[model samples]
Target chain A: MTALSALIRRDIRIALRVGGGALIGVLFFLTVTVLMPFAVGPDLALLTRLGPAILWLGALLASLLTLDRLFMADHEDGSLDLIVMSRTPLELACAAKALAHWLAAGLPLIVATPVLGLLLNLDGTATLAVALTLLAGTPALTFTGMIGAALAVTLHRGGLLLAVLVLPLSIPVLIFGVAASQAAITGPLSFGTPFSILCALSLVSFVVGPFAAAASLRHGLD
Target chain B: MSLIDLANPTRFLALTARVLPWLAGATAILLLIGLYQSAMAPDDYQQGATVKIMFIHVPNAWLSMFVWGIMSVASLGTLVWRHPLADVAAKTAAPIGAAFTFLALVTGSLWGRPMWGTYWEWDARLTSVLILFLMYLGLIALWRAVEDPSRAARAAAVLTLVGAINIPIIKFSVDWWNTLHQPASVIRMGGPTLDNAFLIPLLVMAIAFSLLFITLHLAAMRNEILRRRVRSLQMMQANQKAA
Candidate 1:
């Protein structure tokens, strides 16, 4: 327990100290959100309708941009080897790192989403939906991101590869995230179906992604 | 059967070489008949002659998914059993899978222009297929990006397994989402919706395409094995010269 906590805390400290990745992702989110309105023209109604999808997509892509970095720094500095050889299992260490990543990247994106939601001309209901959907959906990103990170840890140019690997695996999250948000915006949303589906996806990734990542790390070392 | 029956590279090479010619000949015969049947088959009342593209389009789509399935199973074999040749098999299969995917997309687009009145629609089947193609390309890219052969194999295998999630999504995306693509006809309830006239030709083409993939896969695997041998030989020669 203490080891896990230390790992998580160490990862959080590294993420916070770097800070550039979080800033770039948030700025990218804001830029794309603000740009779509101009490109599509001032159809406030249309913007409001698509606001959730736009935010969700932007968040997905933005979070993806930082994924390759999740382990690249550690891998390059040889810290990854240490982590792999640590007393705690690599799977647990991966979970801790993923949690730190979610906190540093996914959590902030969700918190900023509502504010960005307004820029896209989203109404109160849509803003709330967008926020809620992002909140539920981003954990899948962190989990899957760890898998991509582990896979690409040894490569020189892995940013694009990480996107390719992670995005396809992330389709379920994208599907449910959009659905949940759309349900929220439009009338007569039961919400339970999409919400549960989103949770199921997150739960699956949370459980499975760590082990897959650990396996990937082992393969890398081998 | 012994687990290490395939551990010998020379044995694998000899075995594949012996079977490849037969597979290639069978592929040729099957493809010829299949193409002829697909060409001669009657047009659909709703879709007219363009519907005939399904003979090629559907088979390519089938092989696209089917080849990926094969690759995934091979990947699991490689990872679990540490079967050296399975990695080569999976790696060799990637481009063939990509080719099938490309054909599916192109033929689908050709069919779409006349049938759906648009070259592309953001439909579930088409979208999933596009993702599948991307996954193939990514695997192939990873194969080239890594320097070490074993490392490359492991990385690509991990990717193949990770990307396996898209297979089910591709199969069922049409059912789940309200999309422009039509639902499953042959495989769904009430058994074989299309007429036998068209279905037979489609089946022939599908079988022919798969045979062609196997033939091509064997040829490519042989080439890959030869390449690895040549690489090792060159390294040994260089070392000997330096000594």
Candidate 2:
């Protein structure tokens, strides 16, 4: 437990320090959300309807942009080898790293959503709903994106390949996140239904990501 | 020979070398019969001749999923069993599978333009299949990007297994969502809704396509084995010169 906590602490510290790129995800999210209004034109009614989707899309890409940092830096510095060789299970270590990644990277996107949501003309409740769904859904993105990070960790020039490999797998999360927020905004169906599924996706990813990442790391890093 | 005997790449290559011609012959024969049946089959009262497109479209769609099924099994072989040819099998099957998926998409679009009065719809079935196509391309790209063959195979094996999640979703996408594409009429709870005129030809076409895939996959595997041999042999020659 202590070892896992230590690993998580180290990762969080690295991500928070100068040039950590943790804040870059939020900036990218901001840029993407800000750009959408220009592309779609400044029609407030249309923006309100499109707000949840825009926020979700920004969050998804933001998380993806940072996901490679989960393992690439560790692998490059040889810290990943030590972690892999340590007494602690690689799966747990992977989970810890992903958890740290979410804390540093994913959480900020959720925090930024409301501010970005305003640019799209979303009201308080709608912004809260988008933020809430992002809270549930972004972890799923981080965890699953961990698998891609691990798979690409050992390869040369793997950044673009990471996106190609991971994006298709995240389609379900995207669908559910957007759907849940849409339900919260304008709903015949209750928001609870899609929200529950979004939570389920996160839960499922938490289990699967660690194991798959560990497996790929074990196989690919050699 | 038992499955174990074929685990040796040399024996597998020799066996496929002999079997490939016969497999190709059988594919050719079955394909002829299927095309004839599809041609003779009556058109839908509503769709008219465009219903014949179903004869090609359905089978390609089925193989698009079926090829992935084969890759998933081969992926298990690569990851779990570590069989010698399993990596080759999975690697070789990807392009053929991607081609079938491409054919399925193109043909579906072609049929849609005439029947649905548009080239595309963001219906669940169509979108899911498109995702599957993108995944196939991604797998191919990953395989190409990775430098080491063994490492590439393992990374790809992990991906193939993960990507299998989309297969069931594609199969049931119509039923799950009120999709523009029709739900499963041929494979459903109450049995096939298709009549004999359509059913027989569809089945024959599906079987032929499956055979075509097998023949292509085996031939591709054989080629990959030979390609690796050449690569290693060239390395050996270079080492000899250095020595």
Per-candidate TM-score, first chain only? 0.95, 0.98
Clashing pairs for model 1 are: none
**Tens digit of lDDT per residue, candidate 1, span B17-84?**
88888988988998899889888898777778987888888889989989888898889978998888
**Fraction of true contacts kept, per model?**
0.00, 0.00
lDDT of 2 by residue, B38-116 (tens): 9999877776787787778788888988888889999999899998889899999999998998788777766665644
Instruction: List iRMS for all predictions.
Output: 12.4, 13.1
Point out the worst 10-residue segment of candidate 1 chain B by lDDT.
B182-191
Backbone clash numbers for all candidates listed: 0, 0
Runs in model 1 deviating more than 4 A are A1-222, B1-4, B169-191, B241-243
Listed in order, each prediction's TM-score against the native is 0.52, 0.53
Look at candidate 1 and tell me the lDDT of residue B89. Answer: 88
